[model samples]
Target chain A: MWFDILPSFWEGAKITIQLTLFSAVIAFFLAFLAGFGRLSKIKAVRFLAATYVEIFRGTSLFVQLFWIYFALPLFGIMLPKMLAGVLALSLNAGAYGSEIVRSTIISVPKGQTEAAIALNMTPWQRTWLVILPQALVMMLPAFGNLIIEMLKGTALVSLVTLADLTFVATVLNSSIMRPTEIFSVLLVIYFVISLPFTRGIRWIEHRLSAGRY
Target chain B: MSVPLKVIYNEESTKSIGNDLRKVAVQPIVNYSNISKSYGDLQVLRNIDLDIAPGEKVALIGPSGSGKTTLARLLMTLEEPTSGTIEVDGEMLWHQKTNGKLVKANEKHLHKVRGNIGMVFQHFNLFPHMTILRNVMEAPRNVLGLSKEEAMERAVTMLKQVGLANKIDAYPAQLSGGQKQRVAIARALVMRPKVMIFDEPTSALDPELVGEVLEVIKAIAAEGEMAMLLITHEMDFARDVADRILFFDQGRIIEQGSPKRIFNNPESERLQTFLSRFNRH
Candidate 1:
């Protein structure tokens, strides 16, 4: 009986993995862009980045998913279901991820910036070379938590009819009427999927912090 | 015999006078004109007109809160003066000439002007994440645009100068406070700056460690090619290394002269009192 249901769970797991990976890539880039944008000297750029963070973080991810998948088509912005899922997951996660970036950058010692300046590095060189490398290490733990949150958050895509793990589990259980057996498997799959990400971040944090202590 | 002797005297006096006049005519490498800085209601520096000649080793000595460090900071472009202008190597540091009129300097102007200056902080602010060699190599490779090989060669030479060649692979945290400060000196020196500012470079070190850092500084000053602005509480080091010393008190240069005159004569009462404190120590 377990072997019979395994292939169906694998199919849903693939979709879930794809959503997490795609959303994570977009979220990572958005995190740094919006992160640096918030620190920009230009008032307009700072304001725009702050607005992006506030709007995304202030609203629930569920509403954002519903709005993009259901409401956006009302205004004629017809996105595919997959695109909508990725978009909502990344945008929501990116908003939270950006605060991690900004605060970590700020926490880098003021002396580092001054030292770079005294070396005659331009503002850009100082930020990228001196500031960001140190900040990147400090940002990893928080980002690990965020990626796991995003992984779990991928379960929400089931509401839009995408056959991710949770959607497949629900459909399978309704027919078999074996909620305990099926849902237990679903919980294990989710936990299993998120484990590697946590380990990966820790490995990176260890690598980057080599000799820093 | 008397007529020939008089002719020799005139020629010798004329040559000496010419030499003195030429020395006076040489342009100062750093000039601060009517500069003042205020932090809102609190004034840090008053109207200060000062000039540092090329290759001149000038030490600034004062009680804490007398604005000695602020003077070097202004030159390093780390802090801005509220009013007045600074010139580094004959170009304005705080303002630039545009169409024959002075305008507040843009980033390019500031970068170009400040390229001639470098500073070492009290904390020895080495990049803790990078190895000692990379800490020394970073600026020359990135800012000066030297090739990696060239930067590496320069960094190695500077580290050797500061007696840290063995510690090239060590991270900053692995080094002692004195060793860290030496790496900082090498880092600043690798830039080949025209002016190097030491903002109490040895103040943060342990008492025994201070000698090592000071010895490195003394050797650098001995080379006599780069001008140095030393903000120090070590009066003995200042008297030994500085050609001229400026005594600052309450945001003004109360007295400045040859180290001998300032240390021995100490004309001002404040300077006398300041020297007395150091004497007891």
Candidate 2:
């Protein structure tokens, strides 16, 4: 049973990993664009970004997943299940990730902006060279937590008929008729995947923060 | 050895330039023409008109909230004036003439005109992520468009002037209050600004640490050709370094003259009382 379960679990975990990685790339990109937009001096840009954050954060992730997976096909636009899963996860996580990015950037001292301006740096140059580097250091810890949340969110793709870890586990449970053994293995696999990622993020956080003090 | 010789050479040339500058009826390097600033109903500077001569060191001594710092910030373009114009080297700082009329200078115009000025804040405000050398090097490389090697050399020389060349690799957090202020001074000087403004540069430091920062400022003043505006509470230091002193009270200059006249024989009762209060410290 262990040998038979191993191959299925590996295949399931690989799909899970792929969905998580793809969604993560989208989430990270949207996070910065939306985060910086929230801080934009232009009123329209700020309003749009704020609206994006509020809408995604106010609604439920389950409904959001369903909308991308099921509701979009109502308009005659059908996305493949995996891409839909990635889009749902990415959009949901990105909303939360933007807030993390916003708060970390705001936490940087006002004096840093003043110093950059005093040096006659253009606004873009100031953001890129001075404020962003310092803000990035502060953002790393929160970003680690966001990544873990994103990994957990990948579990929901199973409901969308994706052959992710939980979906595979469900199939295994029904076939084997041993819920205890199958679910236990599923739980262990999630932890096993998360543990190395957690360690890697901590190491990066340590290295980035070391030079400041 | 070469650095010290170069410093001496710069000093001699600056002195000759200073003399030649005085012989000609030179325009004021910084002309504050009826500048006024207010935040809501709270006015910070009220119709302030003054001129800073080329190579002149002007010290502004005032009680807190009297607008000395605001005046310095306005010149740095950190704060915009409510009305009136601040001209740096005869170019309008906050306004640009468009077609035939004056319009508020756009960000592009302001950045270009603002190149000739530098300022030091009470809080050292060094970029914490950068090492001391990079803090000094940043503006020159980014704003002045210096190459990396040229910027590095200038930053090293500026740091040496402030006596912090050895600490170039150290970050701001690793430095003391005095050392951070020194780095801030070096950071500003590397731009070779025509007008340098110091807003209570030593105020954030411990009493023992203030002397080192003040010493660096004095050395900077000795190198002529640039106008210096210092907003300071250190009366003795101000008197020693300033060629002229303006005694500020309630957003206005109550009296201004040579440091001797302002310090030894204050004409206005407001300034007399202000001096007595400072004397207690």
lDDT of each: 0.88, 0.86
DockQ of each: 0.74, 0.64
Docking category of candidate 1: medium
Each prediction's TM-score versus the true structure: 0.93, 0.93
lDDT of 1 by residue, B1-281 (tens): 01111111111112112423423444667888899999999898999988787787889999999999888888888888999988787778999779978799998999998999999999988898899999999889999999999999999999999999999999999999999999999999999999999999999999999999999999999888788999999988998888778899999999987777888798989999989987885
Clashing pairs in 1: none
What DockQ score does model 1 reach against the true complex? 0.74
Off by over 4 Å in 1: A1-4, A203-211, B1-23
Which structure among the candidates has the greatest lDDT?
Answer: 1
lDDT tens digits, residues A1-213, model 2? Answer: 555676788888999999889988999899998998998999999999999888889986788889988889999989998998888888888889899889988988888888888899998888899989988877777777777888888889899889999999998888888887788888888888888778978887788767664
True contacts kept of 1: 0.74
Q: Model 1 RMSD to the real structure?
A: 6.0
lDDT of 2 by residue, B86-157 (tens): 887778899988997989999999998888888899998899889898999988998889999999999999
